[model samples]
Target: MRRSMWRVMGLFSKKRQQSPSGSTSGQSCAATSTTSAYELQEKDLGRLHRAAAHGNLAWLRRWHWWLKRVSINRRDKEKRTPLHLACANGHADVVSFLVQENCQLNLTDNFKRSPLMKAVQCQQEKCVAILLEHGADPNLADADGNTALHLAVLSPNTAVAGLLLEHNANIDAQNQEGYTPLNLAVSKHHKEMVEFLQKKGADGHAQDQRERTALMVATFAEDMNAIQLLLWHGADSLIGI
Candidate 1:
């Protein structure tokens, strides 16, 4: 009787193991058809980005539904929709389509950098123009209060700064550290940008909590040109000291 019970228990265990395996496989299969609520991985996302950048209608045709879902999904840690990636890579048509689909206009990444910021940071002038046409805010800042103007200021390109200014970006905007775009130019000793920001209303007198104005910052490594430019721009010699 004991032997007979052992045999019966063995059969039951075997059947239970097989049942669970079959159930799990069916669930996975069901999930695939149930629509992927998951955000694409970086690799998968890269594929979409490449396709959008090229404006390959055929590639888009093959992945349109999936791409659309990604463009609208706000579930990622970065909070970036497909438009953000496309804009960063300068995909004009992709940007237009997403706007038509009503993708979130101001989605920010982990750094509080918006799609518009990405476009500007990468110096994608055409994409920037498209975003502006789609109503992207020229003054949108990162988490640190660094606006698109701030980004342009950080970069060495005066043209990017000029483009942003022409789009009505605030020249006097300060970061969390209170460093205005002019301050950044001075800190980096970017002479042309310093001139441009000053002409565009960048306040050279702006300072951080450490009492460092752009002029004071220019004093860091013996930059006479930046000092002269800041002075020429009306920077107070003792303002931040």
Candidate 2:
């Protein structure tokens, strides 16, 4: 039995080595492996959900007849639909197809995160644009009250941030903790994000649950560039510690 366990472990180790990180192709392979593992472990995930998660467009097409039997908006135990999975895995093609099928654009998962939030969290730029164009509500916060804009800033993806801004995502939308996207960017010492958000008119004076403004958060990090950027954006130095 010990030898059999060792063999099983060795097989997993071999599979892990086959997919190294860094390259885009490698990351896609890793995401596919992760979805496959999830499908194997979770009986709640249906075949269509698994196909969408894996970005298996061909499989989806072949299962067209089966599509009618299953609701496109069907949620698993996690309350995640096929659209959520496709967005989370950065499968732009799958996402486009799902949208074309008229799946609900703003359906939230168990976490209250919409497909747009999932796309931002996964740094899926193309998926983000697609969902936004389909009228996904950018202001919908997750269970933690973090909006798509908040996730985009947290990702520090300038392109995604710009896209969200273009879609009129609430620039000063606060989370459950009262931490706005600008506040988050400043706290994380994301200088370019801070600057970009400021250019987009994010409130530099927005405070968090602790009443700490972006400038105060910048002071805590001792980030000179962030401090200067906030000051340039009119962050009041006297308000926060």
Candidate 3:
């Protein structure tokens, strides 16, 4: 039973990176527009989505004649809006323009992830800050009940996590699996993130759906640094799983 429980924890800790369709991670302007089949093609995206993803400010300008036919907030097949694409691709200018046009800030994509969630997931600090400054709600949960802060813990980007916390993201927000950001940080063996979260007042004794405490999870992973941090925060060592 103990081994099985650890296996379950492993599965939760190793979440796959789910990017939007027709999107590639780490693609830059220098990459040839059609060098490889896997590259994102302009035809695959709607006019607004492509413009936003590529940060084509000229096409997105308010005076463009084609603007009459295209809705500024148009969504593609997967229910991803121009804002979602812009945020995910770190197109800060496009994001700012969209925001100035008063596009919906909290619209969810097919996976129920908002633009702010995508910004954090993609490590777009500029976009994240822009969204937060313009009244984006940091506490909105995605399809998995994971808030922006929850997604922030997935990477070592403590700066992004700190920005989320500054915008009043719930430090103790739990996903559907009942894992808080601290639990996730410990599971991933991210000592810096664990310490950062603790400084932000995450509940050290928080438990998952299985009633497994953060300390218990840390112990299962044998992350001594996390264990010490949790212990220092007054996590009950004698607590049973």
Q: Highest lDDT: which candidate?
A: 3
Could you tell me how far off, in angstroms, the CA of residue 116 lies in candidate 1 after the best superposition? 0.8
RMSD of each: 24.9, 15.9, 9.9
Off by over 4 Å in 3: 1-41, 62-69, 237-241
| Candidate with better TM-score, 1 vs 3 | 3
TM-score of 3: 0.80
Error of 2 at 125 (Å): 0.6
- Between which residue pairs do clashes occur in model 3? none
Tens-place lDDT per residue, model 3, 166-216, is 888899988887888888777777899999998888887777775767776
Q: CA shift at 193, candidate 3, in angstroms?
A: 0.4
* TM-score for each model: 0.71, 0.80, 0.80
lDDT of 1 by residue, 1-241 (tens): 3443234334434434544442221112111121112233555455655565455547766776886666453424456666777777677777777677677778787777788788777677777777777788888877767788777665566776777777788888767767777776766667898888788777776775456667655554346677667666555444321
Q: Write the per-residue lDDT of candidate 2 for residues 1-241, one digit (tens) a residue.
A: 3443233334333433543431221111111111111223346678888889889999988887778777999988888889999988889999999898889999888778788888888889999999999899899977777788888777779899899889989999888778888887776667889899899888877777666677655554445677667666555443422
Give candidate 1 misplaced runs (Cα > 4 Å).
1-50, 53-57, 61-77, 236-241
Candidate scoring better on lDDT of 1 and 2:
2
Give the range where candidate 1 is weakest over 10 consecutive residues by summed lDDT. 27-36
Q: Whole-model Cα lDDT per candidate?
A: 0.64, 0.74, 0.74
Clashes of 1: 0
